[model samples]
Target: MLRASLLASVAATPFFITAATAQDYFDIGEIIVSGGLSPIEANAFGRASNVITAQEIERRGLTTVQDALRALPGVSVNGSSNSFTQVRIRGGESGHTLILIDGVEAAGGDGEYVLSGLQTANIERIEVLRGPQSVYYGSNASTGVINIITRKGAIGDTYTATLEVGAATTATAFVSRRTERGGVALSFSHLDDRGYDQSGDGGEKDGLERTTINLSGDYLLTDDWKVGFTLRGSDEEADTDPSPFGATDADSYVVDDPDEFSTRDERTASIYTEYEMMGGRLTHRLSFNKTKYKSTYSSGLPVTRESEAVKYRLSYGLDGRTVADTDHLLSLLVENKKDSSDDNPLYAREATSVALEYRGSFANGLDVQAGARFDDNTVFEDATTWNVGLSYQIPDTGVRLHASAGVGVVNPSYFELYADAYGYSGNPNLTPERNESFDIGAEFAILDGRGSFDVTYFNETLIDEITDVATGPGAFSFVNQAGKSDRQGVEVSGNIQATDALNLRLAYTYLDAKNPDGSVEIRRPRHELALGATLDTFGGRGSVSGDIRHVSGNYDSQFWQWPAPTVELPSYTTVNVAAQYELSDTITLNGRITNLFDDDAVDAWGFASRGRAAYVGISAKF
Candidate 1:
């Protein structure tokens, strides 16, 4: 890793540069910040969640969701290419975070679901809930949940367009129209970078292209009922370019045939129906979705996968307001997935799961939520999991308190449970890992509602963890270990309206993350902090904002053996600033400067972050 002192001299030279015009650094509000879990709802629970609205996302001119989360606390984004983003949440593994598209599970292949091969144009809002949520979602919910809400058509005609350009000749163009009856949105984005080093696994420039299309229409079968369906598809291509280090970058460990790099195509179709009564107070929802994927690799490997899911839900409101607007929800889900390869038939899997839940509120301004889920795998015995939570608010002081406890179980994935070739064998005796956790938190508003403080403390115990035993220099075998791990941490965030036109946002996380055997988990940090503020002036027409983030040193891999026993990633903070100017009601100019200090920081051994980059964008609405 680069030292702080050396950053000064390295800052003198630019890492990468390309022509840039206007662009959006941020996207608008989405599901996490909308629905019942708005910023206000999150504040009432005192949980550690940061709500970045769609407007905020657009103002920052960011390219994707992964880019936006990179600026938040307790999140470490490590990946050189946009096609592969690895996010470590609260010291959890990269796949720990559950990502949802409009409340539907968006599973990943080989661990890319965190944020990869996806764009921000169709997203209407994004909600990021920190902490375990297996009670509602199910397995792979160890760390938190990221719910992305997409845009739907309105009654009238509306159109939005955007264009952006940056280093590596990266350019994005998106356009959409919402008509009275239906809507259609299409986007084409491409990134061609000389890359920090060589292209995927090979020393060559890297290139990626993604094209997305979405179509939806609703027909009012009756005044109280409606039906609609959506069709979505995406095609992506990426070239292998290896980073300086081992298999860290997208194209690390270059294969023999560079032309066979990587390519993927996907298609998803869904149908839904909704019925409402009592002026929309009571509702029934149902949907069926199917998706298929095809991929080709340079190593002469070909893959095909298919997934199908069906969901049903029912919700109702209390009869009278005197009962604190009590509401109830029940849902059921089932899924089937299959993976096939011409070279490896034993690597395929067939998985299934079902769940039920009950959630409501009391008249005393106290909230409670609970649920249970069961998963049956074709390869192992079935497992069940559950959790419960409660919250209360003091109106006079604007102080809200919340506490929750739960037990969660996770089933192994296709790659972890079935694969038995390539010099390694799958452990048929692997058992599901179980976790029990509890947490308490509070949030207070001060300075006449302009200032706020939020804090949460949590502890969890994990048992029967799954692990891999290396059998050879290039192969390993999977197995369930008779071990337990414990993690406890506290997260604190505060914001102040220092002035009418200025606001400050800051957050920090402290964790004691380790195994029962007293060994620190690899790649998990003990401390992480982020500080940022926005300066708005001239009646909201112009503003400037910047932030600094620091993460304590950590390991990069699980095995203790390394060039050094423990890789000290070190603690380094980078700054970002942006300014906006409104030229007219139809036109606005936005400019942003990232890595202001030009810190040549390297989180992984030989992978370095880009330094001193800028973009200018113009947005207009007709």
Candidate 2:
């Protein structure tokens, strides 16, 4: 009842709606990278997309990439802690989404990237493309793609530094230098937290310590040639509570254990070169990427696991004017990837792929894009995917119509194919999962272009879904489900420049996702809403921003109970506020408070969420 009332109230409010863009409301001239191999203007892109710039990240006082991603339309995030964060898009599974750092794939062996360890200190921008993107990205792109672009060299020499201290004993330091042809950046972050007991009983606090470091640099060989590299490493140690499996006392389901803790270490590196020729109309790029992940868990028996992946990619693009008032671009790509793990000898896989894409823009406000890809796998069936989209703007009406459709594929992971573990065995005969999806939307320029509103509807069907089936008591095996799972949703967003000094933004999503058996999926909220406001004060020297988010009607499984009954999680609302004041031309002071209301919303079953916290920091540029 409360959820319904809130939704109704927000819908009736004229100021509540906005598309996720840069600081402006629906800036059609903005350039985006994830839309295609080449950067394309938002006006010509057909897919539902969002862009969060570095300036916005700083204004909002967001520390991590995951924090900046929350409250976006058709996106949901949940996990037990920062070390295990998972992101789901358009009701798709966590493994169905693909993550890219400067055009390099960043997923682990399981085809999923943990966003908890990605900091925003040196990021330039984040672009999110919703819907199936396998045509260009190949496997593990059944749902969507998140592309993170880091800072690069500036036109002249410059230096920057930042220092921050916050709640939970958190500290951060960042420094960078940029020359005419190259630049380098380094950042270190640490956090020590004394968390509340998840079991709900008064007991010892669960604690955690985490540290992360990032280094990146790039150099320009010539006006049309460039080389760059990025390296990142993170280490985390957290005290964890035991699961509900085999717990005798109800209070013991999620009790903290001093002896139970986990540690994780992750490292990633990428090197790439780009060259342009044919009067700057043709371009070529080659890149190599590698990632390593290791984890150790201590809970009665100590266990450790490790995984690694390597990828090589080469691509070329040709741009020309095919028609009098039309622009065309053709792109070709070839890639090879390999994955391995220490868990089992058979847990190794490799694949090679070829892909082609085309994009065209007309002078009459019409744009078209199409792409196709083929992948050959060593241990699974070969797969093919395709996608097409278009967008049109009506002359002088301030209205734009867009639509997109695509087919995506996701291969089985190494662990799923050859795992030999306690009470669980892998299935080698499993085939790849497939998804078919489409979305249509319209954008309206309202209030004489001072505000904008957008409405989008998306539908998807997943075939050959992967799941584990019980073979006997205390035993299970991976298998492909027979039928298809369905997901559909509506996303509404808008923004209004209320005045010269204030801006308002709103977004709401309604999702209906079901399993093959017509049962509701778990951990996906049916309703999500967000409201935000920013005000510039003190003659533009000071600024303040506040945001409110509400989530409701999500479900989770109680693993402690027999048969693992599913239960609904309590609805939750959280508020965040930030303020910044410029003290000098090159110095600034900033502070923020998160979860101001301290709503204890359980995202995963039996896990206690974090409460209110505050942070303050200073930054300087020289």
Winning model by lDDT: 2
The sequence of per-residue lDDT tens digits that candidate 2 reaches over residues 257-277 is: 667777777777877776656
**Clashes in predicted model 2:** 4
Q: What tens-digit string does per-residue lDDT give for candidate 1 at 388-498?
A: 667787768888887777766666655666666776676776776777777788878889888888788888777777887887887898877777788888878888988
Give model 1's TM-score versus the native structure: 0.82
Report backbone clashes per prediction: 40, 4
Give all candidates' CA lDDT scores.
Answer: 0.58, 0.74
List pairs with backbone clashes in candidate 2. 17-494, 18-493, 18-494, 18-495
Off by over 4 Å in 2: 1-29, 248-251, 297-326
Query: What's the CA error at residue 246 for candidate 2, in Å?
Result: 2.7
Best by TM-score: 2
**What's the distance in Å from true for residue 342, model 2?**
1.1
